[model samples]
Target: MSHYPVHTMATAPEASQPSLHALQSAFGFIPNIAGAMATSPVLSSSLVGLFGNVHGGSFTEPQIQVLLLTNAVTNEAEWAVAFHTTLALQQGLTPADVDAIRSARLPNDPAFAALSRLARTLIEKRGRLDVTDSAAFLQAGFTEEDLLEVIAVTAASTITNYTANVTKPPLEPAFRDHAWHPA
Candidate 1:
């Protein structure tokens, strides 16, 4: 069993409540993972801040979801896989594309394929991308700026992915249909 407490707004430390509130406002409820993360004020706050920046950054919401889902799959974080899978579909990613990401394959769309490949490569290689690795992304029509933004999105998902692995938060019902297991 996980030692971490899945905090709620009322149960979280005072410093963490605001972050939880922000999550609530954004998602209509605080995710169980974020609730567990609330045990640490710093982590919860940092996640919320970085989340805003990443979601508001260069990529569209669907693109961001692609990176997040890819990262979760690569990291083998089950909770994150389910969470991101739900968000990716809600953001209008095709069912085939979502299935492709879950299966460790690229999507059909060129830009999404580039994003999934780059995210998986980033995690699998632990951020060590060579010229060829980056050239492929650029060749797929993403700019250098967009490439860096992928790092930012990856960073954001890494926080959640790692946290979910450690905290082992129970998946909420809303994401139940999309639940994933690492193969």
Candidate 2:
């Protein structure tokens, strides 16, 4: 059983309502992970603020999904894996790219593969990137700022990953088709 209560917008704390509503607006529903996070107004609002910054960062929408999906996969966060798989395809990633991420492999596209590699490395190394690691990401055409932004997106995904692990939210039906498990 889930340790956390999955709050609806109506039942969620007042301070968490806007964040829940924004997630609902963006995704057409309040994800269970967010609902559980809503149990803490601070955690919910902080996630929303961090997500806004991550989305505002220096990458394209599809590229951002690459980073997010990679982090989710690396962290073995099943909920986020399903969610980001859908988002990546919706954002115009090739089906193959999503499949690669679903399989915990680099995306087939060279640029996105580079992104996936860097994201996985960040999590695996706990942000202690070797110089060669950062250089390879830059050599793949991402800027220095983009590397920091990768860290931003990683932070955002890590929150969801940790939340899902703790709360054990059920995956939404809409994302069921894309559900994943880390190999």
Candidate 3:
């Protein structure tokens, strides 16, 4: 296979020194995806900001992981699925929680599980959330705002997953142990 190009801030016009250095400082090395995104600093920065907002949203880390893993699974984006699964684990999601979300089953929390199902459905169906699904989400104790946040999380992951696939960014060493394998 042809190797994907390694993007450097020096070579990618859209990158600035501070942004590049910030990434280097955070990760101890700039991620390949961040490097490729150097081709469009605006895109990279916006994505970072958006995801930060989503991460800061009311949903717990494992809840976010359920949505991400569901999307990645539906999209057949193995890399994203693996990476986010690892993220869930790192954030203290139980093995059962991981398996539940990965299998598209809701754990004991029917409402959240329903929310997970709804996220996967919206992704698979391209934004056509059913009325009952909306009701289910509401019943699950998520507000309209949380639903919007769910969409945001899904959209954010879609962007990164596609970027990583297209750029073939090298998986960070920390993530390599969890490198993708198709389910």
Best candidate, TM-score-wise?
A: 1
Q: What digit string (tens of lDDT, one per residue) describes model 3 on residues 62-151?
A: 788778877776676656766777877887767787777766666555655766787888887799888887888888777999888888
Tens-place lDDT per residue, model 2, 1-183, is 797899998899999999999889877889999999999999999999998898877788999999988888888889999999989999999998898887878888999999999999999999999999999999999899888888889889999999998898999899999988767
Greater-lDDT candidate between 1 and 2: 1
Which of the predicted structures, 2 or 3, would earn the higher TM-score when compared with the native? 2
Give the C-alpha miss distance for residue 45 in model 1, angstroms.
Answer: 0.7
- TM-scores of the candidates are 0.98, 0.96, 0.81
Best by lDDT: 1
- The 10-residue segment of model 2 with minimum total lDDT is 51-60
Candidate 1: which stretches are off by over 4 Å?
none
Q: Quantify all predictions' global Cα lDDT against the true fold.
A: 0.94, 0.90, 0.72
Off by over 4 Å in 2: none
> Candidate 1 residues 81-183, lDDT tens each?
9999999899999999999999999999899999999999988898899999999999999999998999989888989999999999999999999999988
For residue 27, model 2's alpha carbon misses the true position, in angstroms, by 2.1
Candidate 1 has what TM-score?
0.98
